[model samples]
Target: MAVQDSPPVPPNVATTGGKLTGSLGVGSIVFMVVAAAAPLTVISGTVPLGIAAGNGAAFPATYVVCTAILLLFAVGFTSMARHVPGAGAFYTYVERGLGRPVGLGTAFLALLSYTAVQGAVFGYIGAAVNDFVVSHGGPSVPWWVWSVGALAVVGVLGYRHIELSGKVLGILLVCEVGIVIVVDVAVMVQGGDAGMSTAMLSPGEFLSGAPGIAMIFALAGYIGFEATAIFRDEARDPARTIPRATYLSLVLIGGFYTISSWSVVSAWGDEGAITAATDNPEGMVVDTAARYVGAFTGDLVQVLLITSLFAALLSFHNVLSRYIFSLGNTAVLPKQCGRSHPKHSSPHVASVVQVATAGLLIGVSALAGLDPVTEVFAWFAGVSTVGIVALMLMTSVAVLVFFRRSRVDDRLWNTVIAPAAGLVGLAVMLYMTAANLPLLVGGSSTLAAVITVVLVATFLVGVALAVVRPPATVVEVTTQEEKK
Candidate 1:
């Protein structure tokens, strides 16, 4: 079927093999969870620590708040996705729904966010590995080793077919989720040493911290959902599968974070929860497991933590590469960027670009004498949040615009109102991020903060370029062979 009526839908679009099928059932949904949630491997104790230092037991409640907000955002985001199917995600949504200028702006920002996210994961994986190495007392490998290792692994998987990447990710997802459930259940069985506390629900708990810190970190857990469209070509039913993945990802993340946070609180004994979390955020789960379960089991959880972060790196690489590929497909990029690997059926050139950029950034940071964890996680993540925040704002607006112009009244619920709410919610998060940019990256590292600033400025520059000279008209990307 030709995309005659749908401007955003390319003409001559086909049910292409390269495109993800919509059979995205529970397994696909679960793969998303694995990608998005595994990053919590590094986030778990870290978020609670920020809370302990700032909020308290109430940190768990904050996770729930983000869950609701993201759910609202998904309503709009997914609603738009149904009409506009591409790996560019928010960028495509805003471009078609809004104006080209706005669309390109969103696209550029998303590129920043996705690429920065990949960069951020590099540091995170390095840190996870470093943690493991240091714990072993074998004179921990420099963080660069972790970065290199991640590059090698992510590069290899990305060089192959999506299914191979999916399989590897599926295994990691299962293991990570298994560990998270194991920790939560183990804590529950052990019971609270001092009973449940009211702090889990108190507003005062969240208000106590520089609210920005908690909100920003909480936002980190939601990053992988941006990849929802990455599987579009593989989903069973694009229209249905994409929307379901959107909602499923949001709900699963929110619930998973909530339960995990509460389990930590329960393990700590109400009053001491946050403080204990602060003293040892990365170690909190480990300590909790050791306390309630056994040393052997706690050690196992720590090992899985490394695997979880690695899984996150792998997932984000795939997401970012596809984004690159999408940009190339539109001829908005270098012709080479859009080319798929003839042998592997992968976006080889784009994949290499992502790996190279990540390596260069990580390597330079390490050589320049900086902590990869702080530089990678705080700097790139904070910047990406800002960029994604912009996407959220544009997406929310696009939802309203698309429905406003189109005869599609079905979108009033999911596409219009809910997305509007999400936009508002994300805007609040962005305000918080800007106000507390320094704090997001520890507010302590001048270098990290500087790096973030430069990145944001560069994004603006790209937006400026798109304004000066817009990209050529998008042509039919799929072919007759693809339709067959």
Candidate 2:
């Protein structure tokens, strides 16, 4: 099929009235993406579950493997970043390499994935905070009540300038990560049952429990790494900054998860780690902290876990806002949403819409009387992972196609080899995701099928729109940047 005709865009059109400010550096961008991954939450919450349900002692290796796969994916991903310019990340790359129709379809998937994951975080944080409050003699309140309150706070932050959000994320990310690092160190120094060793990293251990399930868990932690490109327009020196941020985030996030998880395995000893995780998955990290660190530190971790969820919520909020803003810019959404805030240089309209959508989802989920973690969080997370994996596979293919035609760079590694490798790797992961969908989402075949159908339906709707809707007509606007 022929590529759909996109409206003519002027050279200066990208810098027109709605442009977000270019003040974020590599640090800022990395912080946002990594925070979206929510290091503490994963290490404390998911790691235990992964160990129990997946490859016990070798779970840390899963992170390493995920990092390698993404680094390979990034070879083509960042390569395309040099040629394509936009805040749409996968949407822009796919459109450039694939076609306008496919690009628009990918955009829909992007929105679905990010929104689902963000809503999942909201559900988790709501239930967590509600429990925390009641445990401390606070007023008894519904989980959705906390969720709505959080939505209000996040909406205010999202409506402000991008830097403000970045700074807030930075602080939260540091606290969450710092506490985990401290706990990891304490565990190592104390040498619980087994002293530190390279045993967990071994292939034998890595492949031990259900590796497929472990891989799924590991992939979820790296969900937001691709957001590096989404922030390209708002980042300083897009070409240099985006690529650096992508690599930096993968290394930092991957390294942190691997090392922290290894510490967990070491604390209980390989033989007993699995049993410990199985017995009390929820307390794996908390119990470790209390044992090695102190009771006070364990309490601190519980508090930080809530903050970690908040960081993820805000980070995803920013991501979804930008996706809407970019779609608006291309006429896929309301023109008003295409406009940036005159004073804050933020996607205020899009942010408001995101908050509203989140509120609706939260409300519906509450009305259904579903368990926050089991139904709301698990189901949404499963769908989001599938969508994200599909997008990654498509984008990797786009990278190869774009380079083959344009020959933008002469290096075979950058243009062809890496993209091909990434394509294969992502294709495998995509299969794993699909195969293990039920396991990822609480083992309900019906729930998994429902989520899968939703994702497929969303993509079809995008395709139908691409086929039926008239092509967008590009318009020029005078360039302007609001002062910081």
lDDT of the candidates, in the order given: 0.70, 0.86
Off by over 4 Å in 2: 1-16, 474-484
Which residue pairs in candidate 2 collide? none
Candidate 2's displacement at residue 116, Å, is: 0.6
Residue lDDT tens for model 1, 353-434: 8889888888887888777666667677777777777677777888788878875567467756787788788889878876
**Candidate 1 local Cα displacement, residue 344, angstroms:** 3.4
Error of 2 at 229 (Å): 1.1
TM-score of predicted structure 1: 0.90
Lowest summed lDDT window (length 10), candidate 1? 4-13
Q: Name the candidate that leads on lDDT.
A: 2
Counted clashes in each candidate structure: 16, 0
Model 1 stretches astray by more than 4 angstroms: 4-26, 39-43, 137-139, 204-210, 444-456, 468-470, 473-484
Model 1 CA RMSD to the hidden true structure, in angstroms? 3.4
